[model samples]
Target: MMAMTQLQSGDRAKIVDLSRVSELVRRRLLDMGVTEGVEVCLKCTMPLGGPFMIESCGQCLGIRRSEAMRIQVERV
Candidate 1:
């Protein structure tokens, strides 16, 4: 298992667990369709450490570092 934020571009992973920080943060990610057992791909990262793009469920989503840190994934 690895942190989603640590994945390199083009790598694929499956969401396994979420950080035990707060329900609000966890719910926010779930609302965006980032749930456990879902497959996600690291597409690209914006220059200058901005939000990174991930592909999942036929949609591409941009997530910031703070948000990404709350998600844990396993390489696939």
Candidate 2:
């Protein structure tokens, strides 16, 4: 498994763990259909350490790089 931050734009991966994330952030992720077992595609990473845009369950969500660093995924 690798951190979500490690994925390149257009890469697809399956979520493995969100254990390192805070409850508030985890809840937000869940509300956006991002959870373990879900397949997500890295749409793009904003320039200069900005947020990352990911597509999960057909929805696009932008998340902070810090949060992305805590999400674990396996390339699909």
Candidate 3:
């Protein structure tokens, strides 16, 4: 397993788990399609520390670094 930040842009991976920091945050991610076993692709990371986007289930969603660190993934 690898942290989401370690993946390069365009890399595809399966979500493993979300950190236990916040239940609401985790639930929100799940609601937005970042569930365990779901495949997702890193789209792009903004320069200057902005949010990054991930493509999953035919949808692209942007998430901040703080939120992303909670996610663990494995290459697909």
Q: Give the Cα lDDT of each candidate.
A: 0.84, 0.94, 0.85
Comparing candidate 1 with candidate 3, which one achieves the higher TM-score? Answer: 3
Candidate 3's residue-wise lDDT over 1-76, tens digit each?
9888899999999999876437887777788977889999999999887888999999998888777777899998
Better of 2 and 3 by TM-score: 2
In order of appearance, the predictions have TM-scores of: 0.82, 0.96, 0.88
Arrange candidates, best TM-score first: 2, 3, 1
lDDT (10s digit) by residue, model 1, range 5-61: 899999999999875536876776688887899999999988887887999988888
- Candidate 2, after superposition: displacement of residue 13 in Å? 0.1
- What is the TM-score (0 to 1) of candidate 3? 0.88
In what order do the candidates fall by lDDT, top score first?
A: 2, 3, 1
Off by over 4 Å in 2: none
- Clashing residue pairs for model 2: none
Runs off by more than 4 Å, candidate 1: 21-25
Clash numbers, per candidate: 0, 0, 0
- Residue 10's lDDT in candidate 2: 97
lDDT of candidate 2 over 1-76, digit per residue (tens) = 9999999999999999999998999999998878999999999999999999999888999989999999999999
**Predicted model with the maximum TM-score:** 2
